[model samples]
Target: MEQLMEYLLHYVWQHRLYGLAPLATTDGQAVDVIDPGVHNLVNSGPDFFNAKVKINGMLWAGNVEVHERSSDWFRHHHDTDAAYNNVVLHIVSAADAEVRTADGKQLPQMVLSVPDYLQHNYQALIDEETYPPCYRIIPHVPPLTVHNWLSRLTVERLESKTDRVQQYLHRTGGDWERAFFITLARNFGFGTNAQAFEQWALTIDPQQIGKHRDDVFQVEAFFMGQAGLLDDTLVKAERRDSYYMRLKSEYAFLQHKFGLTPISHAQWRFGRLRPQNFPHVRLSQLARLYSERRADFSLLTETSSLDALRALFRIGVTNYWRTHYAFGEESRESDKTLQTSSLNLLLINTVSPLLFACGRQRMDEDLAERAFALLEQLPAERNYITRCWERAGIKAAHAADSQALIQLRQHYCDGKDCLRCQFGALYLKQGRS
Candidate 1:
């Protein structure tokens, strides 16, 4: 078993899972646990602190130390460290050795007794091969319990994303617009090219792009060139394409003027991607957005309704892209517009998180709540993880539910952090009862 099983011991102790039987110390002295004490400590001294217990009809209050085996107390060399001097109880899964303090005084030890079925159930979860170790038991949990957990997990996901936005804001010297642009650019990748897009965004100054936003062609040239899509060699080889030639020439002038370096096109991926999701198409759509709404980009955080937010992203690529997914390539005529699914992704991953971060930095609760409200109005995402939850009989009702499930799967279930998960904890508790 992994060392994480030690947390299960902590859970058993915290919830007093020793059953209705009388408790006692290792030396056969009757014992009673009055208060499990505070488990939250910033700097660790012991596993638990300020515990109050009655031993042999005498009350004793001190710290409680836990381990898988009593010998770990000495194995960890707690005898030499003054930190373990005030330990009133040494709770372990097995008491294989006598524990003594630094002053050579015998400390009370107890072997924590847990129900056999609980341990068996936890071990079964650990050995389970499913993505969520407790998938089989998820439906057994009360709906209210699952809803409460999902709500908390969704906020946790939002807070984590908001933290990233805050880091970017700090890196950009508190420039909210630039941070938003970088985040939006990354999201445009839609998971396939997010990293390359982020690197490309970092290379071009948003102010430089904003300077030429009045001309959609100039914005397109700058964005495409910075993304390394308008390389001189590639453009020269496709000289027969007038639109490619124009962008190449404009990018050359802009590159020299701004002394801007472009990210390598080798970083972009094209395999297994839909034609509409090609990097060239995504960049064009992003270029159109900035070209039309450079000055009002920050106003997106204040958008209250889902329709208003959706309206802001209702933009299509320039006419040049209507017949092409990339330079020097001709396909059937089609309007390269941001689809509803793509728009929903942007609102969930980029817009809402940015809004939440902005609200937190400004201490505006209304804006933060508005950001969460927008998530409620959006539809649930359809992806492999959501489908896994669906197969397990957990259907996500909205974006918040789906987002929370994504978080739960990635952070808790995948890592086998059952002790920290509500579902896992409930499963263990139910098995014990």
Candidate 2:
């Protein structure tokens, strides 16, 4: 077993799963645990702080230390560290040595008695090959339990996204509009090209783009040019269409005027992607969005209804893009408008998180609530993780549920952090019963 299994021992101790039978120290003195104390500490001290226990009818309250073996106390140099001076109890899986404080006072030691079934169950979980070790038991868990867990997970997922938004805000010197633009640009890539898009956004100064926001053509030229899509060699070797020529010329003037450098065109991925989602097409749509909305995306956060948010993102690329997915390649006439699914994705991954972060920064609960409410208004995402949940009989009804499942899969299930997950804890608790 990995050394981290000690965390499972910590979990068992915290929950008092060692049964109600009278406990004893290695010396055979009767013992009782009144309180297991706080196990989660931000700073280093003891494994658990401020514990209350009764030994031989005497109540003692102090810090508690835990280890896989009692000798770890010395191996960890607690014998010389004055920080462990007041430890009242030493709980270890095996008591192989005597422990003492810096003052030479022998500390009481107890061999934590975990139930046999709990040990077997934990071993079975760790040895299981499935994504979620307890997948077989998921369907058996109470629906209310699953529902409550998912709700909490949804908040956790949103908070995680909001954390990234805060990082962007910090990098942009707390400029909300610039941060939102960066986030929106990143999300416009959907998934395959998200990093490249984010890198592109970081390179371009949003203030420069704001200057030409009134002119869609100029905005498109600037964005496409900075993306390196209007490379002289590539554009020249291709069709050299009139629109392409204009963008090349405009970008040449803007490049020198602003001292701008374009990102490598190779950063974008086109493998297996639909033409509508091509970098060229998405950049055009993003240009139109900026031209229409300008630097003020506060309207996105202030919207009262989901429909209003949907309407705000209901934009399409220019007429030239309607026939061309790339700079020169002409295609059949089709409306390259943002589809409902793509719009929902952008709202979920970009707009909602941005609004949530704004609300948190500005202390506006209504905006954060609206951000969460918007997720509930959209359909659940269909992805591999969600499919796994569905196979386990946990069907998501909305984006909130889908996001929560993603959090659970990525953070808890995949990491094998069952000891910290409520659902995993519930399953283990049921097994003990």
- The runs of at least 3 residues in candidate 1 whose Cα sits more than 4 Å from the true structure, single-residue gaps closed, are 2-4, 22-65, 71-90, 96-109, 130-132, 232-240, 294-297, 431-433
Instruction: Assess the local accuracy of residue 352 in candidate 1 as a C-alpha lDDT between 0 and 100.
Output: 86
Per-residue lDDT tens digits for candidate 2, residues 287-380, read 8888888335778766767777788888888989989988778899877889899989988998888878888888999888878888898999
TM per candidate comes to 0.87, 0.89
Q: Per-residue lDDT of 1-433 in model 1, one digit per residue for the tens?
A: 4254467678788888888888889889998999987774357578888899999999999989888888888888998779989889998888899989897879999888667877887787888998677888888889999899999999999999988888778888988888888888899899999999989988868767768888999999998989998876554575438898789899999989999889998999989999999988988888888888832545786667788787888678889889898787888998877888888999999888887888888999988887788788899999999998898879999999999999998888887778778888877866455
Instruction: Supply candidate 1's per-residue lDDT for 94.
Output: 84
lDDT of candidate 2 at residue 429, scale 0 to 100: 66
- Worst ten in a row by lDDT for model 1: 231-240
Q: Who wins the lDDT comparison? A: 2
| Candidate lDDT values, in order | 0.84, 0.85
